[model samples]
Target: MSTIGSEGWTLVHQARQKHYDDRYYGHWLGTRDDGQWIIGRLYPGKSMDDGFRDGEWAYSKRFAGDPSTDNADAALTAYVEMAHNTFVWDRVFDQTVGEAIDLYWAGPEVPDAPKLAAGWAGAESPNPDRVVSSAGCSIAMPLHEAKFLLLHYLRRTELAAKAHLTKGVTVDRHGAVEKVRCATGPIRFEYGYNTYWLT
Candidate 1:
């Protein structure tokens, strides 16, 4: 693995192939200058090492007009600033992060209740660092941010476990509690709990 920075954004590029059953899967994960966690989705024919070499591959379609109208699940869809107790989309798509995520979840495709329930749990949770209560009710940000992070954590952890079972080699395979912070404050993600905290 290698670290690269530019214009305040720090990217950690995985410098090796990430594969399963001899099939290569490629994706990117990094933090923007503002301390928000960002991730790129996997694409066929590209290994994680290839993504490192390509560099900023997700922005390729940035100038293709409007992201909102594009339904394609491109490499980099949207990002959130969990640190600030707020979320920000790349504006690369016309849909909000919540909408995009739901669209993918509520589908004609086979339903995975186990996965769906996890997302729902994230939606119902409050900001761990700050929970404002009013009239026996609590207010919180949209479900997308928490859902996104939790899902990613769950997925990566599963992958790591699978690799371990197979006795395969991998890098950055473990998942655990991670925190991201900025001027706004800090957000803590506890993968073990399958939840997150926003301040």
Candidate 2:
């Protein structure tokens, strides 16, 4: 059973906040039978409130027209792909972290150890020394290399979590490129150590 209630209106409001106006509006209307329930004009750059009643009406009309058409399913799919692209992940780290790491170590090839180590001074440190050591092929590499390697591992963990939450997508370790894609496209990353040692 499908019903377009206040929740649907809430989603419409949310969509309007994201700048998706009328042209993108119809997709959100739930199915209705008589089509009378579908209200509102598809105006460009209109407020979500302006279209709320109409959108609800349209949904009701679609449902009235054919209850078995799976209108809710279609609407939900569109919402996930378009209206909620980032819903699967949260912003756990500051934007500067990504920027600093990219500026220092991002390139077509892996950077040299010393240069990579220099970038980790103020970044978030990876957990578990064993994971860090395993990632960098033994901790002999410069601090930066270990950090870079750790960042790569953390990114993989985040990607896996996102895929699991959104669309039940799972990327195998063998398919590294595919895994990266699931991380919402490529961006620069950095690795940092928990503490520095001085002689």
Model 1 clashes, total count: 5
Per-model TM against the reference:
0.24, 0.21
- Residue-level lDDT of model 2, residues 79-191, one tens digit each, is 33433332221243223233333222222334442422211122232334323322222344444444444344544344323333323232322232222222222223321
Backbone clashes for every candidate come to 5, 21
Instruction: Output the TM-score of candidate 2.
Output: 0.21
lDDT tens per residue, model 1, 155-195: 43342233343233322122222221111233444332233
The residue ranges of model 1 lying beyond 4 angstroms of the native Cα positions read 5-8, 12-23, 46-48, 59-199
Q: Highest TM-score among the candidates is held by which one?
A: 1
Q: What is the lDDT of residue 160 in candidate 1?
A: 24
All candidates' lDDT scores?
0.32, 0.31
Residue 1, model 1: Cα distance from true site in angstroms: 8.4
